[model samples]
Target chain A: MSTTQPHKKTSGAYRHGDLKKALLGAGLALARQGGPNAVLLREVTRQVGVVPNAAYRHYANQHDLLQAVRSAAMSALANAIESELAKLPSINDPADFARANLRAVGMGYLKFAQDEPGLFLTAFSVPDDLQGTAVPEKAGNSGLNPYQLLSVALDRLVDTGVLPNERRMGAEYLAWSAVHGLSMLFIDGPLRQLSPAQRQIVSQRLLDMVEKGLV
Target chain B: MSTTQPHKKTSGAYRHGDLKKALLGAGLALARQGGPNAVLLREVTRQVGVVPNAAYRHYANQHDLLQAVRSAAMSALANAIESELAKLPSINDPADFARANLRAVGMGYLKFAQDEPGLFLTAFSVPDDLQGTAVPEKAGNSGLNPYQLLSVALDRLVDTGVLPNERRMGAEYLAWSAVHGLSMLFIDGPLRQLSPAQRQIVSQRLLDMVEKGLV
Candidate 1:
């Protein structure tokens, strides 16, 4: 079990309050390798050179640790979205900006899923009512979580008259269903074997469908 | 261990050729209860009143059994789509009938995902290259698999001029992405708690998006 150590650090005891962070680091490493199912409390503690009881001092159970890891994963996903949003060139038209914002959010989401599938899967491993829960832990440097970012993009569309006010009610679900479904298909479904070039084509096509369909 | 027996038959030995079918029956029961991961050889054999080795004769390994169960689940999903297709009233207008056919396929998929989430999850547990792999085992009564059924609907759209022939190349993926993504969100993601009426509304809206987007 010790053969595949999480890091090259010696198996020394963690300094006072750093154990939780250390355990979380180890858990993230595990999730990066395998997916949500890989982040076990025992494995995390062992990787951190501590006993499982020490982990319990920070997290009540494996589920609690998983939740923490999931939050971090969500934050990472938000950061990915922010990175894409930040890359947009200044647009004069509000409609073009709104359209670009929505596309950036989706492109960021697909890129994250492709690049960090394990963490991506871990981020959504547990279900939560994400309708309006804008907790800071899941936020990016822009102070918005992934879902909130999507809502903002859609709201921009409505404001710009690109997407009608009446159609904006649950447009999040409609758009999210398309992008998220394509991500899942790319990551874990039959499309898993698609080449990166093929994936790019399909991804663009899916986004086109969402943009055209939503409005 | 036997408290939740797969069937009410006594712990008697199986007849020569009946063991394979009995084991598959038990495996399907397990899949219905807990999705793909639940179909274990040991548990299946135990449920079938046979030793572990008895299962090896039928299934080379757990994966082989899971493949069978997944195929069965695929067939079940195809049947659900076919059942919805059967409900369509013969219309005089070709375009209207084509549109209705596509909607019926999407509706049947969503209904099956809601009504049989466990089996739905099990069906998509493994990632096989589903493009053009129309095997007999996964076919419905109409001799069409789920992917093929979606393809047929999309083809009908082009045939009736509801969808442009140029856009018909990969419209199946676009439509499947929306319907499948919505299904996953309903069953395992943040949208799991949506009420049936709300789900119904969302389902129609998603189908609407697909129909509009595809064309």
Candidate 2:
């Protein structure tokens, strides 16, 4: 897809204006194989068949490149949640819809971690300096980051009067922590041994617990 | 500390049975400096003035040594939690004591992560095979791993008649996940930026959420 057309080759200098996107794609591929640790700059340059200098033009440093990849990961995670949200049957009542939608947010989150463990890790492990920059929901381009989506879901709970306004303060942290912990345990801890069916039961139970705990 | 006494230096062969302990200590120090990756066998041996063969005698591979380090980390974590439990005011009622004790457990976990972030990472990042083996509560001699402590707390909730038998099927996961997520976020996620006072507030709020959510 990056091959230049003959008509566009009139200029002597090489022009890969979409180099940033290519580099990010290569970074994601590297992360997929060896995790965040693998997204090295020179390696990414080689993967994209670009000279180191060209890659540098797009990313000032490895951290910059990783931040972009993390942002992409956030977008992917949000899309995964969106997929789950789509799978749910239509809900009539506002509270019921909010609750179901929030549950879908968590289920999508867990499913993404389970299915795309590497991406999930890279997404959440955005390095210290680059964190706020890659926030999925705040990404001017992407519709919502995971945290923003979670916040929206929690807002719905408050709006429906399911959770008191006083209790709603930082309610997202409670639900997020529970779901995130389960995902890490499932992907990187002892829970990795659970069979798919057992995992489903456990996931549902965990979400149920989070729902109950938050309200 | 493993240095041989002058009186016992007649033997040409070096026999340090404490080599394992020294290696594990060195491994923990390395992890402290650079997380799990720095706990390499060669580096550990170099740190302890031992040859690779001597290190190999105690640990077949880096993973084995890491597992030992992870176990030590768990022991350290249990000690930290035990330390917190000791600081609690004496409560006459079993239920009240249990509640306070459970809260201490979460506080200790967070404190450990905040104060000794490196060790906390090593403790929870126990290599897959070493996971159940290094459980914080089941350290045999240590009295209770974190899981068992959580279970005891949940048992208290059930005993207090606050939570029904059906509701307590797996309440520990709820509390553990919430607390663990908070720790991870504090140490490695965006929550790292929060001030100590802010963290304290959030910590108490999260624990309250867990307490309320479980029942």
The TM-scores of all predictions, comma-separated, are: 0.86, 0.82
Question: What are the per-residue Cα lDDT tens digits for candidate 1 across B1-215?
Answer: 76544554466534545888888889888887777657888999899777999888888888788788888888899999999999999998998998999999999999999988777877876322222222324788888888789889888889888888878755777888888888988877667778999999999988887888887
Which lDDT value does model 2 have at B116?
Answer: 75
Model 2 residue B67 lDDT?
77
lDDT (C-alpha) at residue A101 in model 2:
84
Scored against the native two-chain complex, candidate 1 gets a DockQ of 0.31
What fraction of the native interface does candidate 1 get right in terms of contacts? 0.38
lDDT of 2 by residue, A131-154 (tens): 234224433134777787778888
Clashing pairs in 1: none
Best by DockQ: 2
lDDT of each: 0.81, 0.76
Q: Which candidate leads in TM-score?
A: 1
True contacts kept of each: 0.38, 0.41
lDDT of 2: 0.76
